[model samples]
Target: MLRKKKITFVINYFYPDLAATSQLMTELTGYLQKDFTITVIAAQPGYAGENHQSKKLFEEGYVETIKVVRIKLPEVNKNSKVSRLKYISSYFFLANIALLKEKGTDVIFTISQPPVLGGLIGTIGKLLKRSKHVYSIHDFNPEQAQAVAYTNNQSVFKIAKIIDKLNCSYADQVLVVGEDMAETLRGRFEDETVPNYTVISNWTDEDAIVPIEKSEPAIRGFLETHGLKDKFIVMYSGNLGLYYDLENLIQVADKFREQPDIVFLFIGEGAVKERIQRYAAEKNLENVKFLPYQPKEFLKYSLNSADVHLVVNQKGIKGVSVPSKIYGVMAAGKPVLGVLEQGSEVQRLIFESGAGVVIEPQNYEGVIHAIHYLHSLDPGELKSMGLKGRAYLEENLTRATSINKYRQVLQAVADNSPLEHTFQPKQYKEVVHKK
Candidate 1:
């Protein structure tokens, strides 16, 4: 039997951690384990919850073949920019110490987590392991920092740009989650020798999150537990963080305070979560609810509890970030009301799938108008829109589709051969689902 090539992933967090990036890395490594002897070097869990022991080599129950190695770093919550950087820098400092102990790897996969530092660590890991490197951009670094006004240091920005450029230039294959992001990457290194790049989008496990009737016991029970039963639920699930203009949605909820049936639910934690909570409480908005993220197993019920889903992005964040929750909402067969920029990839998906309505960011009136329009729709019509979204998700954004792309890329890089398949961006007109 041919031995499987080894591929070690260097990330800040991994399985048992609920971060979007952590869960994504878990899913990717889990799926890739069949073809690769998978190993993950991650931080001792800190971002979301309690810390687990920094075990040397622990096997993941879900994927028995994969091994995880955790590193100890300063425990810091991402509550502020300075604190966040401290968290990132500590990981960069300690993770290198951890990587020196790693060997016998064919490829090193790292994401933009500790910002540009994660890629730099991956580059170093590649050299130490004597393996090809694959740098995956989860979010653009210093640009994202600047977009959110996290820092105003020109010196810091210059340093970040240099690190980012080096990571891209050093990697054997560069991976981005969306086409808009790919365009952003191209723009970043326009004058330099461009690296091999591909758009392998984050995906949803369709089988796990399929449509369930609101009448279903699990779905109804979740709504009841949240005091959301029989309400026209407008849910904004996922991280309530920077680069998401959720303030506009909260304002819209205030406008609908008199409407007892309309409830605005914000799920997940982040830097702005407390601020939003305070704002809603000060306004005495009884129809609004905030909940922590549900376990992955309960996502199907939690997601199906919504009558319509909300996806919001901050202005000027088209390519800088992409909301990973959209695909899960799509898998749940739910219509979305996206408050995003015109050319954003989310807007493009909504328009193409006839899955939802797209309103520009920070448009409070537009948010109210969209809610009213969706509420006015016949039940059958709304269900049909959701059906269209699920169809598109299966065809384009399924886990199988994305994993296949990664498998092929890893295989090509392992064999030192040219990638056989590449997906290009195409334009499609907005499809309006007419009754």
Candidate 2:
């Protein structure tokens, strides 16, 4: 029997981490395990406030057949640059060291976490191990950072951009999560040779997160437990992070405070989570509520509990990042109130699928109007609209479709052959569904 090729994944989050990237990576690695000898190097579970203290700097374990190496790092305070730097720097150094310890690695795979450092690990590992490198850009930094004004130091931004460009240049194959992001990658090498890249959309588990009736026990229980029973829930689920303009978006809740029946639910945690929480408290926005991240199994119920979901990005974030929560929202058959830029990937998806209404980012008036418009729709109309998104996802963006693409790409690269399959973004058919 031919031995399977070995691929070492150097990523910050893995199996137990509740970050969306962690879940995606964990799923992708599981799907690829049959074809590759998989090894993962990741930080201890911490994305969702899980405390895992390890005496050893590195602990090795297995998630089923896949080998995992967990690195011990200091806790992250997302609000502090100093704390973030310490966490990222420690992971970068320890991940590199872990990569050196893995034997017979044929490929090094990394994502754009911790900004450039994740890709840098793959680039350096390629040189040290004489292996092919695959860099998946989940978010393009410097540009993403600049979009939200995360940092104002042009010198630091310039240096970071240069390093990431080099990481791209050194990679054997670059993978971007959206078509808009693919354009952003091209912009990095204007009038120069662009790296070989593929646009692979991210996915949620359709089987696990199918649409359930509001009356379903799990759904009803979750709603009642959260005091959301029979309330008009407008949920924003996922990282309460920098890129999504969520801190500012939280202000929109105040506009609806007079409506006792309307509730704004913000779920998950991030750097700006506390800031938004404080604002809600200061304003005494009784209509707005915050919840911690739900367990993976509870997502289907929690997601379906919402009347309409908010998918958003900060202005100027058109191609810099695509919010992964959109997939879960669609999977759960929930109508969207999208605050996304025109022609952006998620915006286009919502429009094409007839999933929901979209407005320009930073247009608070538009958001307010869209929410009212959606709320005016009858329950059947809202259900039909959401089903359209679910149908679109089933046809074009299924987990099988994406995992198969990843399998093919990794296989072709491992064989040092040109990719035989050309991936074109699916032109989704108009999916009209009745409830």
Candidate 3:
């Protein structure tokens, strides 16, 4: 019998956490387990305040074949910038220590979790274990920090920029979540030594998140539980973070406050959750509702509960980040109202899939117009659009499609074979980063 190559993953969150990164890593590790002896070095999952028992080895049956090393670190309030910085610095130091403990591995894959710190740690893991490093840029660093105004200090930005550049050059392959991200990276790292990018859009489990009819028990029960039965729900599920333009969304919700049948739902957690709730309260907006992240098993119901799902990005975040929640919305067979920059990847996807409408950022009137247009559609016509989205998702963004691409990349990198490169850094002089 042939031995499988060893591949270690270094990330901040893993399985138990419902954060987008956690879900993506969990699925990736699970899918690659048969081909690679997987090892995950992650923090004790608590980004969303869900407590998990500390374990040095993630030998739990979640992914029975892989080995997981969970590092112990002080809990910090995510709302506090000082506390988050403390946590990031601590994790960077301790995670490197954990990586140094691992033995021979063929490749080390890491995501941009603590931004550039995670990628830098992957380099250390590669050097210590004598393995190749594959840097997965889930979201761009320094740029993402700047997008959200996470830090105004020039020194911090400079250090992040330097580390980011080093990680780009150090990795054997640079994996990005979207095409614009690939273009952006290729433009930034013009040096030939910098790793080539392969675009791998985030995916959803088709079988698990199949379209649910309103008559389905799961959907019915969810609506009943939330007192949303017979209401036309416009839901924005997943992270309510800094990069999202929710001010206009809130205003849109306020516009429908007098209409008893129109309910705006905001699900999941993030920095902006409380602000959203408070704003809705201040306006006495009775049409809006907020819910915490639902368990994975019940996600289909929560996701499908919305009549028209929303996916939003702020003005200037086109290439720097892509919201993963849109995939789930597509999987649920629901029409989307994408509030994003014009000509963005999200707008393109939504239009291409025929699943939703796109509105420019901060366009409160556009938001109102979109909701009314969707509301004006025949139920059957809306269902047809949703069905188109689900079909598009299955054909283009299914887990199998995504994981197969990853498998090929890993195999090619492992064997020193040529990758089916998607973007060449030298071809483009500038990448789009506009509002």
Q: Which candidate number maximizes TM-score?
A: 2
* TM-score against truth, every candidate: 0.93, 0.97, 0.92
Task: Estimate, for each residue in 1-435, the C-alpha lDDT of model 3 and write its tens digit.
Answer: 977888878888987877888988899998899988898888888877788765443322335787888777777866788888899998899888777777877888888889899899988777667788888998888988787677789898888888888888878888887777876787676664446667777888889998888899978988998899999999998887888877556877877877889999998888778888999999998889999989989999888888899899987788888899888999989998898876666777788788888988878798899999998899999988888889878777778877887888887777777764432223223322211
Give candidate 2 misplaced runs (Cα > 4 Å): 428-435
Ranking by lDDT: 2, 1, 3
lDDT value, candidate 3, whole model: 0.81
lDDT per residue (tens digit) for residues 364-397 in model 2? 9899888889888999999999999999999888
By descending TM-score, how would the candidates be arranged?
2, 1, 3
Clashing pairs in 3: none
**How many backbone clashes are present in model 3?**
0
Preferred candidate (lDDT higher): 1 or 2? 2
Report how far off residue 132 is in candidate 3 (Å).
0.4
lDDT of 1 by residue, 94-197 (tens): 77876666677788888898889989998887767678998888888888888777777889998998889899888999888877887788788778666778
Consecutive 10-residue window with the lowest summed lDDT within model 3: 426-435
- Which 10 consecutive residues of model 1 have the lowest summed lDDT? 426-435
Error of 2 at 399 (Å): 0.4
